[model samples]
Target: MQFVILCKDKPDGLDLRMATRQVHLDYLKDVGGANLLGAGPFLDDQDRPTGSMLIVEFPSEAEARSFAQNDPYAKAGLFVDVEIRRWRWGVKPPAA
Candidate 1:
Protein backbone atom coordinates (compact mmCIF):
# COMPACT_ATOMS: atom_id res chain seq x y z
CA MET A 1 0.00 0.00 0.00
CA GLN A 2 0.92 3.61 -0.36
CA PHE A 3 0.94 6.12 2.43
CA VAL A 4 1.40 9.82 2.73
CA ILE A 5 3.40 11.07 5.65
CA LEU A 6 3.04 14.70 6.53
CA CYS A 7 5.45 16.16 9.02
CA LYS A 8 5.50 19.66 10.40
CA ASP A 9 8.74 20.72 11.95
CA LYS A 10 8.98 22.53 15.21
CA PRO A 11 9.55 26.23 15.17
CA ASP A 12 13.28 27.01 14.86
CA GLY A 13 13.94 23.65 13.28
CA LEU A 14 15.71 24.99 10.22
CA ASP A 15 19.12 24.84 11.82
CA LEU A 16 18.69 21.32 13.06
CA ARG A 17 17.19 20.25 9.78
CA MET A 18 20.12 21.63 7.87
CA ALA A 19 22.63 20.10 10.26
CA THR A 20 21.13 16.67 9.90
CA ARG A 21 20.22 16.83 6.26
CA GLN A 22 23.04 14.64 4.98
CA VAL A 23 22.38 11.84 7.39
CA HIS A 24 18.68 12.08 6.65
CA LEU A 25 19.41 11.88 2.97
CA ASP A 26 21.63 8.89 3.52
CA TYR A 27 18.89 7.16 5.42
CA LEU A 28 16.46 7.89 2.66
CA LYS A 29 18.87 6.48 0.16
CA ASP A 30 19.05 3.29 2.12
CA VAL A 31 15.27 3.07 2.00
CA GLY A 32 14.93 4.52 -1.46
CA GLY A 33 12.42 2.25 -3.06
CA ALA A 34 10.01 2.58 -0.18
CA ASN A 35 9.64 6.25 -0.98
CA LEU A 36 7.71 7.03 -4.10
CA LEU A 37 7.69 10.80 -3.74
CA GLY A 38 9.01 13.14 -1.08
CA ALA A 39 9.72 16.76 -0.36
CA GLY A 40 10.47 18.90 2.64
CA PRO A 41 9.62 22.24 4.21
CA PHE A 42 6.19 23.66 3.86
CA LEU A 43 7.92 26.77 2.59
CA ASP A 44 7.15 30.36 3.37
CA ASP A 45 7.28 33.67 1.57
CA GLN A 46 11.06 33.33 1.53
CA ASP A 47 10.84 29.79 0.04
CA ARG A 48 12.49 28.05 2.94
CA PRO A 49 11.63 24.62 4.17
CA THR A 50 9.36 24.76 7.19
CA GLY A 51 8.12 21.19 7.20
CA SER A 52 8.15 17.94 5.20
CA MET A 53 5.88 15.78 3.11
CA LEU A 54 6.45 12.22 1.93
CA ILE A 55 4.60 9.58 0.01
CA VAL A 56 5.88 6.07 0.49
CA GLU A 57 4.93 2.49 -0.24
CA PHE A 58 4.78 -0.17 2.43
CA PRO A 59 3.13 -3.43 3.18
CA SER A 60 1.08 -2.12 6.04
CA GLU A 61 0.41 0.90 8.18
CA ALA A 62 2.64 -0.60 10.85
CA GLU A 63 5.48 -0.67 8.38
CA ALA A 64 4.83 2.92 7.40
CA ARG A 65 4.72 4.00 11.03
CA SER A 66 7.92 2.17 11.74
CA PHE A 67 9.65 3.94 8.90
CA ALA A 68 8.48 7.29 10.23
CA GLN A 69 9.49 6.48 13.78
CA ASN A 70 12.95 5.50 12.71
CA ASP A 71 13.53 8.43 10.41
CA PRO A 72 16.64 10.39 11.29
CA TYR A 73 14.69 13.62 11.16
CA ALA A 74 12.05 12.26 13.46
CA LYS A 75 14.60 10.81 15.88
CA ALA A 76 16.38 14.14 15.93
CA GLY A 77 13.16 15.75 17.09
CA LEU A 78 12.65 17.69 13.90
CA PHE A 79 8.94 17.13 13.57
CA VAL A 80 6.47 18.78 15.89
CA ASP A 81 3.77 16.58 14.44
CA VAL A 82 3.60 13.63 12.04
CA GLU A 83 0.54 12.28 10.34
CA ILE A 84 0.29 9.13 8.24
CA ARG A 85 -2.60 8.34 5.95
CA ARG A 86 -3.19 5.42 3.64
CA TRP A 87 -3.19 6.70 0.08
CA ARG A 88 -5.32 5.74 -2.85
CA TRP A 89 -3.14 5.99 -5.86
CA GLY A 90 -3.96 6.75 -9.53
CA VAL A 91 -6.31 9.68 -9.34
CA LYS A 92 -4.58 10.82 -12.54
CA PRO A 93 -3.16 8.37 -15.01
CA PRO A 94 0.54 8.50 -15.67
CA ALA A 95 1.55 10.50 -18.70
CA ALA A 96 2.14 8.31 -21.71
Candidate 2:
Protein backbone atom coordinates (compact mmCIF):
# COMPACT_ATOMS: atom_id res chain seq x y z
CA MET A 1 0.00 0.00 0.00
CA GLN A 2 0.99 3.63 -0.44
CA PHE A 3 1.32 5.91 2.54
CA VAL A 4 1.84 9.61 2.91
CA ILE A 5 4.11 10.87 5.62
CA LEU A 6 3.51 14.49 6.49
CA CYS A 7 6.01 16.08 8.81
CA LYS A 8 5.81 19.49 10.39
CA ASP A 9 8.99 21.11 11.56
CA LYS A 10 9.30 22.52 15.01
CA PRO A 11 9.18 26.24 15.43
CA ASP A 12 12.57 27.79 14.63
CA GLY A 13 13.84 24.50 13.32
CA LEU A 14 15.31 25.66 10.02
CA ASP A 15 18.90 25.39 11.17
CA LEU A 16 18.48 21.88 12.46
CA ARG A 17 16.63 20.86 9.32
CA MET A 18 19.38 22.16 7.10
CA ALA A 19 22.06 20.54 9.18
CA THR A 20 20.38 17.18 9.06
CA ARG A 21 19.15 17.33 5.48
CA GLN A 22 21.90 15.40 3.78
CA VAL A 23 21.78 12.56 6.24
CA HIS A 24 18.04 12.53 5.95
CA LEU A 25 18.25 12.30 2.18
CA ASP A 26 20.72 9.50 2.43
CA TYR A 27 18.49 7.64 4.81
CA LEU A 28 15.55 8.00 2.47
CA LYS A 29 17.56 6.76 -0.45
CA ASP A 30 18.91 3.84 1.51
CA VAL A 31 15.71 2.64 3.01
CA GLY A 32 13.01 3.94 0.73
CA GLY A 33 14.60 2.88 -2.56
CA ALA A 34 11.98 1.84 -5.11
CA ASN A 35 9.24 2.16 -2.55
CA LEU A 36 9.82 5.89 -2.30
CA LEU A 37 7.27 7.18 -4.75
CA GLY A 38 8.03 10.82 -4.16
CA ALA A 39 9.24 13.21 -1.44
CA GLY A 40 9.87 16.87 -0.92
CA PRO A 41 9.77 19.76 1.51
CA PHE A 42 6.79 21.95 2.20
CA LEU A 43 7.64 25.56 1.62
CA ASP A 44 6.39 28.70 3.27
CA ASP A 45 5.46 31.96 1.59
CA GLN A 46 9.12 32.97 1.59
CA ASP A 47 10.04 29.69 -0.10
CA ARG A 48 11.63 28.31 3.02
CA PRO A 49 11.01 24.71 3.91
CA THR A 50 8.76 24.32 6.91
CA GLY A 51 8.03 20.63 6.71
CA SER A 52 8.15 17.54 4.52
CA MET A 53 5.88 15.27 2.54
CA LEU A 54 6.80 11.80 1.45
CA ILE A 55 4.86 9.08 -0.34
CA VAL A 56 6.11 5.58 0.01
CA GLU A 57 5.00 2.00 -0.39
CA PHE A 58 4.82 -0.42 2.49
CA PRO A 59 2.92 -3.57 3.23
CA SER A 60 1.58 -2.24 6.50
CA GLU A 61 1.13 0.98 8.42
CA ALA A 62 3.50 -0.30 11.10
CA GLU A 63 6.39 -0.46 8.63
CA ALA A 64 5.55 3.00 7.35
CA ARG A 65 5.55 4.34 10.89
CA SER A 66 8.85 2.69 11.54
CA PHE A 67 10.29 4.35 8.46
CA ALA A 68 9.09 7.75 9.62
CA GLN A 69 10.45 7.32 13.13
CA ASN A 70 13.87 6.33 11.86
CA ASP A 71 14.37 9.32 9.59
CA PRO A 72 17.41 11.40 10.43
CA TYR A 73 15.33 14.53 10.79
CA ALA A 74 13.01 12.68 13.13
CA LYS A 75 15.95 11.33 15.10
CA ALA A 76 17.40 14.85 15.31
CA GLY A 77 14.12 16.17 16.69
CA LEU A 78 13.44 18.58 13.87
CA PHE A 79 9.77 17.83 13.62
CA VAL A 80 7.00 18.96 15.89
CA ASP A 81 4.51 16.59 14.35
CA VAL A 82 4.46 13.65 11.97
CA GLU A 83 1.38 12.14 10.45
CA ILE A 84 1.17 9.05 8.33
CA ARG A 85 -1.84 8.00 6.35
CA ARG A 86 -2.91 5.70 3.54
CA TRP A 87 -2.87 7.54 0.21
CA ARG A 88 -4.49 7.25 -3.15
CA TRP A 89 -2.95 8.76 -6.27
CA GLY A 90 -5.86 10.11 -8.21
CA VAL A 91 -4.00 11.97 -10.91
CA LYS A 92 -1.05 11.42 -13.20
CA PRO A 93 0.25 8.35 -11.54
CA PRO A 94 3.39 6.92 -13.07
CA ALA A 95 3.00 4.55 -15.98
CA ALA A 96 3.24 0.91 -15.04
Candidate 3:
Protein backbone atom coordinates (compact mmCIF):
# COMPACT_ATOMS: atom_id res chain seq x y z
CA MET A 1 0.00 0.00 0.00
CA GLN A 2 0.98 3.59 -0.57
CA PHE A 3 0.87 6.27 2.07
CA VAL A 4 1.18 10.04 2.15
CA ILE A 5 2.94 11.34 5.22
CA LEU A 6 2.15 14.96 5.95
CA CYS A 7 3.69 16.98 8.72
CA LYS A 8 3.14 20.57 9.83
CA ASP A 9 5.92 22.32 11.68
CA LYS A 10 5.52 24.40 14.79
CA PRO A 11 5.85 28.13 14.36
CA ASP A 12 9.35 28.07 15.84
CA GLY A 13 10.46 24.82 14.32
CA LEU A 14 12.63 26.20 11.54
CA ASP A 15 15.75 25.95 13.64
CA LEU A 16 15.00 22.40 14.64
CA ARG A 17 14.25 21.47 11.06
CA MET A 18 17.43 22.99 9.78
CA ALA A 19 19.50 21.38 12.47
CA THR A 20 18.02 17.99 11.82
CA ARG A 21 17.99 18.09 8.03
CA GLN A 22 21.18 16.14 7.47
CA VAL A 23 20.12 13.36 9.80
CA HIS A 24 16.69 13.31 8.21
CA LEU A 25 18.17 13.05 4.75
CA ASP A 26 20.45 10.31 5.93
CA TYR A 27 17.53 8.41 7.40
CA LEU A 28 15.66 8.75 4.14
CA LYS A 29 18.65 7.41 2.30
CA ASP A 30 18.80 4.44 4.65
CA VAL A 31 15.18 3.55 4.08
CA GLY A 32 14.86 4.46 0.44
CA GLY A 33 13.98 1.80 -2.03
CA ALA A 34 11.46 1.21 -4.76
CA ASN A 35 8.86 1.90 -2.13
CA LEU A 36 10.13 5.32 -1.24
CA LEU A 37 8.53 7.34 -3.97
CA GLY A 38 9.09 10.98 -3.11
CA ALA A 39 9.66 13.47 -0.32
CA GLY A 40 10.02 17.24 0.05
CA PRO A 41 9.57 20.21 2.31
CA PHE A 42 6.57 22.52 2.21
CA LEU A 43 7.04 26.25 2.10
CA ASP A 44 5.03 28.93 3.88
CA ASP A 45 3.67 32.22 2.50
CA GLN A 46 7.11 33.83 2.65
CA ASP A 47 8.75 30.73 1.11
CA ARG A 48 10.20 29.52 4.39
CA PRO A 49 9.82 25.81 4.90
CA THR A 50 7.01 24.94 7.26
CA GLY A 51 6.43 21.26 6.86
CA SER A 52 7.12 18.12 4.90
CA MET A 53 5.44 15.58 2.68
CA LEU A 54 6.61 12.04 1.96
CA ILE A 55 5.12 9.53 -0.43
CA VAL A 56 6.01 5.90 0.20
CA GLU A 57 4.82 2.45 -0.67
CA PHE A 58 4.98 -0.47 1.76
CA PRO A 59 3.49 -3.85 2.31
CA SER A 60 1.07 -2.65 4.95
CA GLU A 61 -0.27 0.41 6.73
CA ALA A 62 1.62 -0.39 9.92
CA GLU A 63 4.97 -0.25 8.13
CA ALA A 64 4.11 3.00 6.39
CA ARG A 65 2.97 4.65 9.60
CA SER A 66 6.05 3.33 11.37
CA PHE A 67 8.24 4.85 8.72
CA ALA A 68 6.71 8.28 9.31
CA GLN A 69 7.02 7.96 13.04
CA ASN A 70 10.74 7.25 12.76
CA ASP A 71 11.67 10.20 10.56
CA PRO A 72 14.46 12.28 12.09
CA TYR A 73 12.36 15.45 12.00
CA ALA A 74 9.58 13.65 13.73
CA LYS A 75 11.89 12.19 16.35
CA ALA A 76 13.32 15.64 16.96
CA GLY A 77 9.86 17.07 17.63
CA LEU A 78 9.94 19.54 14.76
CA PHE A 79 6.32 19.01 13.82
CA VAL A 80 3.23 20.36 15.47
CA ASP A 81 1.07 17.80 13.73
CA VAL A 82 1.55 14.76 11.58
CA GLU A 83 -0.83 12.78 9.42
CA ILE A 84 -0.35 9.48 7.65
CA ARG A 85 -2.96 8.36 5.17
CA ARG A 86 -3.42 5.70 2.55
CA TRP A 87 -3.25 6.94 -1.03
CA ARG A 88 -3.29 5.86 -4.63
CA TRP A 89 -2.14 7.42 -7.86
CA GLY A 90 -4.95 7.96 -10.31
CA VAL A 91 -5.68 9.87 -13.46
CA LYS A 92 -7.48 13.14 -13.08
CA PRO A 93 -9.07 15.01 -15.96
CA PRO A 94 -8.62 18.73 -16.36
CA ALA A 95 -11.39 20.94 -15.06
CA ALA A 96 -13.55 22.68 -17.61
Candidate 4:
Protein backbone atom coordinates (compact mmCIF):
# COMPACT_ATOMS: atom_id res chain seq x y z
CA MET A 1 0.00 0.00 0.00
CA GLN A 2 0.93 3.61 -0.46
CA PHE A 3 0.67 6.29 2.18
CA VAL A 4 0.86 10.00 2.35
CA ILE A 5 2.96 11.13 5.27
CA LEU A 6 2.05 14.70 6.13
CA CYS A 7 4.29 16.20 8.77
CA LYS A 8 3.95 19.59 10.35
CA ASP A 9 7.04 20.79 12.11
CA LYS A 10 6.99 22.10 15.60
CA PRO A 11 7.04 25.84 15.97
CA ASP A 12 10.54 27.17 15.22
CA GLY A 13 11.90 23.73 14.65
CA LEU A 14 13.55 24.44 11.36
CA ASP A 15 16.92 24.26 13.09
CA LEU A 16 16.15 20.79 14.29
CA ARG A 17 15.06 19.72 10.86
CA MET A 18 18.24 21.02 9.32
CA ALA A 19 20.36 19.38 11.96
CA THR A 20 18.94 15.91 11.32
CA ARG A 21 18.38 16.08 7.60
CA GLN A 22 21.39 13.95 6.73
CA VAL A 23 20.49 11.22 9.16
CA HIS A 24 16.85 11.38 8.11
CA LEU A 25 17.79 10.97 4.50
CA ASP A 26 20.11 8.14 5.36
CA TYR A 27 17.44 6.35 7.31
CA LEU A 28 15.01 6.58 4.46
CA LYS A 29 17.65 5.31 2.11
CA ASP A 30 18.51 2.33 4.30
CA VAL A 31 15.08 1.27 5.56
CA GLY A 32 14.52 -0.56 2.28
CA GLY A 33 10.80 -1.14 2.80
CA ALA A 34 9.17 2.16 1.95
CA ASN A 35 9.71 4.18 -1.16
CA LEU A 36 10.01 7.92 -0.87
CA LEU A 37 8.10 9.03 -3.93
CA GLY A 38 8.04 12.76 -3.25
CA ALA A 39 8.86 14.95 -0.26
CA GLY A 40 9.54 18.56 0.60
CA PRO A 41 9.11 21.17 3.24
CA PHE A 42 5.71 22.85 3.46
CA LEU A 43 6.18 26.54 3.01
CA ASP A 44 4.24 29.09 4.97
CA ASP A 45 2.73 32.27 3.54
CA GLN A 46 6.10 33.94 3.97
CA ASP A 47 7.81 31.10 2.10
CA ARG A 48 9.33 29.54 5.15
CA PRO A 49 9.20 25.84 5.87
CA THR A 50 6.46 25.10 8.31
CA GLY A 51 6.06 21.41 7.67
CA SER A 52 6.70 18.56 5.31
CA MET A 53 4.81 16.43 2.83
CA LEU A 54 5.90 13.00 1.76
CA ILE A 55 4.38 10.35 -0.48
CA VAL A 56 5.66 6.91 0.27
CA GLU A 57 4.89 3.40 -0.92
CA PHE A 58 5.12 0.29 1.19
CA PRO A 59 3.70 -3.20 1.30
CA SER A 60 1.17 -2.31 3.97
CA GLU A 61 -0.29 0.64 5.78
CA ALA A 62 1.29 -0.59 8.97
CA GLU A 63 4.68 -0.58 7.40
CA ALA A 64 4.19 2.91 6.12
CA ARG A 65 3.04 4.15 9.49
CA SER A 66 5.94 2.39 11.12
CA PHE A 67 8.35 4.13 8.86
CA ALA A 68 6.82 7.45 9.79
CA GLN A 69 7.02 6.74 13.50
CA ASN A 70 10.62 5.71 13.36
CA ASP A 71 11.77 8.45 11.08
CA PRO A 72 14.69 10.45 12.40
CA TYR A 73 12.73 13.65 12.10
CA ALA A 74 10.02 12.26 14.33
CA LYS A 75 12.57 10.99 16.81
CA ALA A 76 14.18 14.39 16.88
CA GLY A 77 10.91 16.00 17.84
CA LEU A 78 10.75 18.05 14.70
CA PHE A 79 7.13 17.32 14.03
CA VAL A 80 4.32 19.01 15.85
CA ASP A 81 1.79 16.86 14.02
CA VAL A 82 1.97 14.04 11.58
CA GLU A 83 -0.67 12.32 9.52
CA ILE A 84 -0.65 9.14 7.50
CA ARG A 85 -3.27 8.47 4.90
CA ARG A 86 -3.63 5.50 2.60
CA TRP A 87 -3.04 6.67 -0.93
CA ARG A 88 -3.78 5.71 -4.50
CA TRP A 89 -1.31 6.56 -7.23
CA GLY A 90 -3.25 7.12 -10.43
CA VAL A 91 -0.78 9.37 -12.14
CA LYS A 92 1.31 8.54 -15.17
CA PRO A 93 4.22 6.08 -15.36
CA PRO A 94 5.82 5.19 -12.06
CA ALA A 95 9.22 6.45 -11.06
CA ALA A 96 12.06 4.57 -12.66
**What does each candidate score in C-alpha RMSD?**
2.0, 0.7, 4.3, 1.9
TM-score of each: 0.87, 0.97, 0.89, 0.85
Top-scoring candidate (lDDT): 2
Tens-place lDDT per residue, model 1, 30-63, is 8755455555558978988888887787889998
Model 2 residue pairs with clashes: none
Candidate 1: global Cα-lDDT?
0.83
Q: Model 3 residue 93 lDDT?
A: 21
Worst 10 residues of 3 by lDDT: 87-96
Q: For model 1, what is the alpha-carbon lDDT of residue 79? A: 95
lDDT per residue for candidate 3 within 1-96, as digits (tens), equals 878999999988999999999999989989756668889999989998999999898999889888888889999999999998999866662232
Assess each prediction's global lDDT (C-alpha) against the native: 0.83, 0.96, 0.88, 0.86
Candidate 2, residues 19-78, lDDT tens digits: the string is 999999999999989889999999999999999999999999999999999999999999
Model 4, C-alpha of 94: deviation from truth (Å) = 2.9
Looking at candidate 1, what is the lDDT of residue 85? 97
What ranking of all candidate models by TM-score puts the best one first? 2, 3, 1, 4
Query: What's the residue-level lDDT of 93 in candidate 4?
Result: 41
> What residue pairs clash in candidate 4, if any at all?
none
Reference-based lDDT, residue 42, model 1: 80
lDDT of 4 by residue, 1-96 (tens): 778999999998989988999998888788733488877788988988888788898888888888898999999999989999998988784767
Instruction: Point out where model 2 deviates above 4 Å.
Output: none
